[model samples]
Target: MADQPTPDTSPATGSVPEARIVIENCAVATVDAQDTEYARGHVVVAGARIESVGAGPAPAGLRGVTRRIDGSGHLVTPGLVNSHHHFYQWITRGLATDHNLFDWLVALYPTWARIDESMVRAAARGSLAMMARGGVTTAMDHHYVYPRGSGDLSGAVIGAAAELGVRFTLARGSMDLGTSDGGLPPDFAVETRDGALAATEATVDAHHDPAPDAMTQVAVAPCSPFSVSTGLLRDAAELARRKGVRLHTHGSETVEEEAFCHERFGMGPTDYLASTGWLGEDVWMAHCVHMNDADIAAFARTGTGVAHCPSSNARLAAGIARVPDMLAAGVPVGLGVDGTASNEAGELHTELRNALLVNRLGPHRESALTARQALRLGTHGGARVLGRAADTGSLEPGKLADLVLWRLDTLAHSTIEDPVAALVLGAPAPVTLSLVGGQPVVEDGRLLRVDERAVAAEARDAARLLARRAADA
Candidate 1:
């Protein structure tokens, strides 16, 4: 996470009728344990929770008591869950495209040092808007960048998510080790260990809601093993445990990072993370591109979650993760869009598609992902990683009414016979209707929140200004 912005009143969040809503005659992919697919279905949503999921028309009990949406040609699925992201990096897209991870960060650190409240807000709004438009209902943004004097960057991001109406988890990421102390980040970008811990606790107390249906929650993230001190990692884990917040950080993202861990700690990345007390059910690591067999087992044994960012990994030339092996070993896995700078797109639909292609390209092609499985990785898999599976992953009765309705009538999906296959393998389409906890956030392919075009224009301008500042610096 990283920068600046002011509050913008949301232009819309379509009227959420208090009465029940019955979506009839739709092709529904439940993505449940049984992988249920309904040729024709109806879902009754009362308040923010789903009342029932059944085949065919609205239940007789719901006749005139509910608002009925004729879903004759649409496909409805549980909203995609984005496990990890750097929302602030939306302003840094397309720069250092030819550079690998380390070089890319080295080049952008100075420019990031200039981010303020306004820039942070614009980036968050723009990023969330795109994600929402692309069918992401729940998201976790691991924002760790805190340039000196950049006041309350996390708060600004939380504010943006609130306005956008996405289920958000603000991973309060930190870096306590600077270049002077053998870390990758510059000194100005690093905070004192004590400062980081204090902020973590404060942020959690102020913004981390533990409710089952929480709209916003907080997590502890110390950037990565290379950017934070060993002591800080341990302290962060302890702090998060005490505060009852989830833990997150970059881990085994590349061969270079693995080598750094070996040289610095005399152990592999997973071992070093375990030494810092970060191996547990409450923790979710961003990348495990270089995990060994033992590392995969450890994640399974400890119940640690993995957030796989296929597009960003490919863009940065980071090696492919052993996702097939990890899933086989029982390690929970989810999909992420990663930082916008690396991916340059907030399209979670594309991420789902890349995940399908990347897994097939690897040696694990024998264990390659199916379209429905990839869809699961983006939904239930992500929910498990973010520790929110119980409430929002599948379209079961009593679950949250968070879902996306896609029009399969488009040229991109017109000829598809299988709705699920059409969704996963076909060209990505803007979500026709999106709802978060039964509240409409996108209606008929238009954002029901802020002015989408104005937000995009402002974010574009901000990105150009930030790029020029970085160049000048």
Candidate 2:
């Protein structure tokens, strides 16, 4: 809480020491500087921190060892980070099929307007559980819809994340512009500008944690340019800086969005965002698929980050994000699974594959993105986007022990000689273990905190109930 945890090569800060857990005989992809890899290696976890990570066997005489694990058939990497998502849409999957970005938002806003705390709690629980099983140790959810009388929606989702045991960030989002003002969301679905700003500040104050190993944090997100007023966007950015939290929003995701920005504000998506003081080191925008050279340069110059959602963009017919170009131009880039409504899988691991394949379909083929690049995007790249790189992104001695053990020895993946290739290009590898701050959240490819079956059942019921509520309205 007082300082960024010291770099791993140094001693544990302060006086309190932790019980140690060791894992040996595994393939390690540190995802650190130099893209370090070990064909056979060991990782030692001490309480909530990593004690050491190295090749060919763990150091001997490790004291205070509580549990020793043999990671023979698994490949260990920094836990995947989901930089952008909508956990509330977990129950709203498979809707607005065959629609573009504009049409999709219009179709879904009514049902979203009907959401209450119970439904969102169930939905977020299910969504986080799914991502955890897929090896997501750190997750961020952007929940923007605030219907009248929706009691403690952010609290409900935050509670679910705590129960499931993943490091989480709730980007308490808002929409102050509606169809009446030429925005995509319905009039009743939007909140007043003052109300939105006030609520966002309250959420940050109640939930945001400045600790290096915090379980939950909050960001200020005002939906998107089309769905939020210019004043709201401008004020939201200022408020986020005032509170010392990060800012998130949708940008340049679709041709329609770009056209809307140009028509309304006489500028492109990136330009309009900058006009409102929304571009900077502390800001990360979702789905920068439509960015041009100038926009990319602006992002690079400002040290802004991008959350690339490959599958979601493809699902909604949003073009491929200029990920290769953005990375080349020095813009920080990370991966996002987006919302289950658009990306029903809602898993971070699959984004690695999707990002690789989708970018190959972009202007630069083959060299668009490699398996290692995809792995980095899901791991350390996302850490940078969420402002948690120093603590949780890579496998270093003093960093938080947030990582995943992918069972690459399974029949589906065993044939692939390279562990990283098997993980990225091959079939979905089962997660044998996933840890957040040295705590086990998933084991044997299932959620350890909550019953997976029960979570799915709750989400199913919530989805059906939500449909009824929307229909009645």
Candidate 3:
């Protein structure tokens, strides 16, 4: 049932009636259990579920297909999944350009603290539009900053994702430790621990859908070890387990974070997280750049997953993550764009190339990562990290019709011999079409549901407003 689309009744979804779709005369890369690939093939979709995929033209006599798209000069693959992000940061890009992990957060915290519902909504709209147009069918946001009375920030983000027509997960993040308590964020930005927990629970109760075909889901997330208290971490783990939701947080992204863990709790980030009951199958942490062999072993042993953000890590001068070692050690790994503040190119396809290039700089250059492995990290690996692998990772019968048609015949990519290699190593390919739940989210290199120019203008205004408010305060 993986990749099954939600059977939505909402009036706002679109006007297109559900029907069959057949895409033929194109290549297929089904990142399935056996890594199936075909130089020329076809795919059939009935309503929201994939009906068939094979090496030749879609079996003849396919009936009732309202959409018959000739996918010549294109390669079809599973839609990319973004395992981690900060949608609110869409309006905060290009700031703190020369700072490392800690300084970058410190510099951006004030502006982020001034965000409200309106600001977050605009920012999220721009973010989701960019990703969806770039072939991301599923996205997740880790938003933690809650200034005193920012009305419904989570709702604002959720609404934007819905408006853009992409599967979404709102990782309800909180930060309780403030400057007064030896933490980094200003006191005014931090929420009361109890209040944060209560709000997270309520958000889950209201928005989370457990159905395999659900379009929206919720996760319990604390900001990070340095900015969130010990009690909060333990309690969050318990709450997430009780509610049967996944857990996410920042972990081991920098040496400074490790030093903080050692100074405050007499352990490294991974050990501290484990002591707080945060290491388990349902938990996926971002960065993991500074993990040692022991930490890798622990993550593999506990079935914990890691989200690899290569561009963000490189931008912030965070060390290269031990991705090859983790993979060899059996740790489930995925790719994340992190935040636009750290990685201005908030697209997932580029992450595939960056992940492949950055990991090769280390001692194990030969085995760091392969192009196919990189693609897996962006698609199936992300699904596994979000705890939804059984629902939306690969292209197989019975999975949701969430996939992309990359135009590899363009001038930039046509000369390359291998489609997969050209996609990962060559310049980024254009998305001819992207579908979410048997509907067109993007077509002909443009977003179908919203105006791109309008979205850009809204994002600019929101960023300006947030900056002014921060200055005024």
Candidate 4:
């Protein structure tokens, strides 16, 4: 772990030895401005940024690169970006799978209220490790369920990310509207409006890094309209803007939510969001499933982003988001595996696959999304949503060398004519190599910084303890 690669190893202008990392002879999907691809290519990663990407072996005059990786027979793509997740929900998998979004929250809010520091640390580590193995280099987690006794659970998740060596974005999520306040969340799972805003600001001041190569960033994210007050939403937006961090929350996830907003605020979800000053470039909402054409146009005009969680929406019977229409309308859309309770796995591959299939299911089959487009939603689009587009989205030169090498030569993928297509169409494959900031976090399909088995065992213990406590309560 001490020797894990970091980007700051070399000076910006000095004639230091370029610890150039060369991955030779592989199929490259750059996913850059041009959506470039190479049937057979090589990528040179020096320090933390990509120095060059081209066909064949490393170019001439490239020296001081002692590390060499055999990328042969693999499909190389920018590491998947998970724009939205709930790391603490890793312990809640297989629960309330048959319930819709509202019922699912009703069934699990009490259980989530049991989360503490230990539970969050174990769960976050397990979830982050799972994402790392599946080629996700960057992840954004929205964790708002803060019990009274729970102390700094968000920090615990950030600690787990540090241990895993993956880039992390923590959405300092809050829920202030409890069931007593005409909201969906239980009282124990909600916070006071003032308290929520204070904690959000404190978290940002303490952890929000504005550096170009920051491994961790913070965003102010109130849980959702159904679980938070309008005042909190406005305040959170103001605080995030003042602190120069992004804003995130759930929106238009279900028709029930729309009805709630209409009955409570005399408008739809989008209208409520706009009234609260949350409709802008700095805001990215999760699950715009019930959005109308006008809402889509508003999102486009405002440059607001969306995190499309396909598997969780399907599992919860939440309506499919009009993603193709959103994309056509120029809404910046990204991929998210939501929470483990609904998705059953912290896997970006599931999100990518479901995003492609779900878009083609309804009347829009004639204009169905292609495999490449879905892949972009997981990679490039995710970066844009998370406000990390200038850094780690693609495999272009000068970008952070955060990428994945997948064994497309395996039996499951070998049958396809295109390797990229195989990745989108086939089952989720373990990454042979995964790098974040030029550090190989997953080499040969195994986590390097932490023991996966120990993490899983610890997580299981914590989850079992939580389940027992919830049952007794």
Candidate 5:
């Protein structure tokens, strides 16, 4: 018999071309328009884009790549998008755990005023890593606290995001009214109206990216009605519109805010916003917990979005938002983790779970919110609020490949019958891998871009120093 031909073992001898990544034998949850779920599927990624997705083997005609990722026994979905956050507050978590929103602000304002560029950058990096581990790929950070001569804290946050490789919408938040001016914040924590506007313009000019798939963008956010003058809100809105950016602010977060609006502006929160031309598709407000039917109608008609921070609300004893009613009213609603000092966590997945449970407390009949609905609020709905739905929030061709892969072998999900439902009902788990714009920033449940433990330690030291400085002041 003729000698059997030995199998070719050379590196380039095989005809089977390499794939950038082959997520094989995984359950794919494509949160697309049709809400399709692929069980035991494969995802082929090439150069930061998903080349193909289907069940079974790769097509024979496909060509070469470099890496491959086995995603068997994992659940893959579009990454969670956090619509609202204060990344700086990660340094103040647990400081005001028992206070309401108003009292909490009063207690923390002085400490927040002590933040420098380095401290703010450390906090931003820590927050981003925490959120990424929780499966958040895109986040909108409302960083409004700019102490006098702190040296551009907003730019520090942008730099941190760039280093972390997470898509960031840095809302240039401003507060113009100090306690002397009948605002909630102290004088040191507030800026002059003109200074705030100038800073807003400078940040927008320097960092705002209007193009699709932008990693960083700037939104003009005048902190809130209680801490910002009417001129600031209106000017911020005008500036946002003029620059084609978005506007964000805290509105109707608590009953105290309603009273403040009534006493100062002689109108409800939503009405005050409308009177100042702040209601529009280009605007999204955080914590609309006390909005009424008229307010909801106005939001719907004006195409204004709302960021529902359920965990923060519950923690602060604030009433639940009329999320179901707001959804029924056709308002674009997204999930927000709010400030870490308020909610004590930056986990976007936990926010989605809380959002589902809180919405059920409403009087609406039928299912309050499906797991899929909750997931949408975290992904597509949040993308809509940040004005990036067309480029993110869904797994599709031409969109930025921002996504998370979660291991399903955890005890919480051991008996889950539906992987999608398990995501919302099961206990939260750290993301096994997280990607933004097709770049892997987190792999194997750890951040690949930064040393998280070191940053966390820095944050702890910074927080202690801030506390000491604030107390001395």
Candidate 6:
């Protein structure tokens, strides 16, 4: 067995200074711009940004000035980025596990309506904590279900991310079409179109940060075609563009969704989005499993991105997305775990592995997505989808030091085979350490920024209370 790497001994002194963090003796899989990999390498992290990378130890003159981490038998990569999620759904896992997309929504909508600000906050914290341990440094969450007169759901998520120390993009999603309006969601869960747009604007004005190293951002997202009016989608896209923020939403997630688009709008979901001006570089659609060749070409031409949620698609029996086709067409693609209710687990590493397996199941001539490609989907691909590629994707000089270290000596990854393949083909394990912007959120397989046990307990109580309310109704 490969000897275990010595634990990171660099003391957590005051905030890391502008000096570099020399991670010596480790095999660096730096997913640099040219897809370069330096086997026995070192990374120089200067304060919150990566300063430089080389194939060997630091030179004698530069050795003693900064903190040193001995990385003996580990694999270092960019921290995973989750392109789409619903953090509020963490408390609703297993509620409708056996149901399909529509049935699952019908069953869980009432429980979600019972959620308050505290529930949202607790669930967000718990989800972030879980993903952090699993090496997700940045995540975008779509919180669309707002009960009648419910306080700002986006605020709760923002507060949670602040407390938990993860980069977050809180997409203020809205559902304006209730059952009375021929939508799947009930009346209480849908917000008025005017109120939704106003709240979106308020969130953006107060929270959306456009800076290069922004820790938080806000996006405008009208829930979905079947749950929102055409006017709201177009207006949201326009509002997002005007605010200089991005747009996000669910699109063509299931056959039911495609059928609804065909029956209601007389076009496919992608065409409907195109007509509404929702197809562009600043927009990313989640769960685009039903898009055809034309849709893929349209996305490439317009520079639209896709958030491919393989696990959720499989769990909900929504068909596999044409990820290979999208990649071939030059459409940016990223990984999303979707929601805890559908995926049950929010581990970005597991999602990355699943994406590899699902893509390989397609035609033989189609290139099998490799572990390196899967890792890129979780890192660079996601950064591009979230409009942050200029800052956070690869481990180049001046990029934020958002990174993860996975121990390679574990039982699940014992063999001395390809390190990249070990990550995708072996059993999943929690990251030993995860850093976002040079700050450690998970160290030694534990969350360093929050109380994990207490958060889990609170989420359990909240879930029970909400489940009771749903049962009573």
Preferred candidate (lDDT higher): 1 or 5: 1
**Clash total of candidate 1:** 12
How do all models score by TM-score? 0.95, 0.96, 0.96, 0.96, 0.94, 0.95
Q: Higher lDDT: candidate 1 or 6?
A: 1
Q: What is every candidate's alpha-carbon RMSD to the true fold?
A: 6.4, 4.8, 4.9, 3.4, 4.5, 3.5
Better of 1 and 5 by TM-score: 1
lDDT of 5 by residue, 1-473 (tens): 01122232346754764335556667888778888778877666666667777776544444564445566667888899999999999988888888888998888887888888988988898888888878889988999999888887988899999988999999999998998998777798889999999989999999998888789999999999889988888888888888999999999999999998998879999999999988999999998999989999999999999999999999999888998888888999899999888888778888888989888887763478888888888998999999999888887766777888888777889689788878887888557778787788887788888888898898898888878888898
Model 5 lDDT, full chain set: 0.85
Residue range with the least summed lDDT across 10 consecutive positions in model 3: 1-10
Worst 10 residues of 5 by lDDT: 1-10
Alpha carbon deviation, residue 98, candidate 3 (Å): 0.4
lDDT of 1 at 391: 95
Model 3 ranges with Cα > 4 A deviation:
1-18
Candidate 1: segments with Cα more than 4 A from true spot: 1-18, 63-66
Output the worst ten-in-a-row residue range by lDDT, candidate 2: 1-10
The top-ranked prediction according to lDDT is 2
Backbone N/Cα/C clashes per model = 12, 1, 5, 0, 1, 0
Q: Which digits, one per residue and each the tens of the lDDT, describe model 3 over residues 402-457?
A: 98989899899989978888888888789888888888899888999999999999
Query: What tens-digit string does per-residue lDDT give for candidate 1 at 174-248?
Result: 998888998777899889999999988999999999999999999999999889998899999999999898999
Expressed as tens digits, the lDDT of each residue in 364-401 for candidate 6 is 33476878888889999999999999888788878999
**Cα displacement (Å) at residue 65, model 3:** 0.5
Kindly report which residue stretches of model 2 are placed more than 4 angstroms away from their true locations once superposed.
1-17
Cα deviation of 98, candidate 5, in Å:
1.8
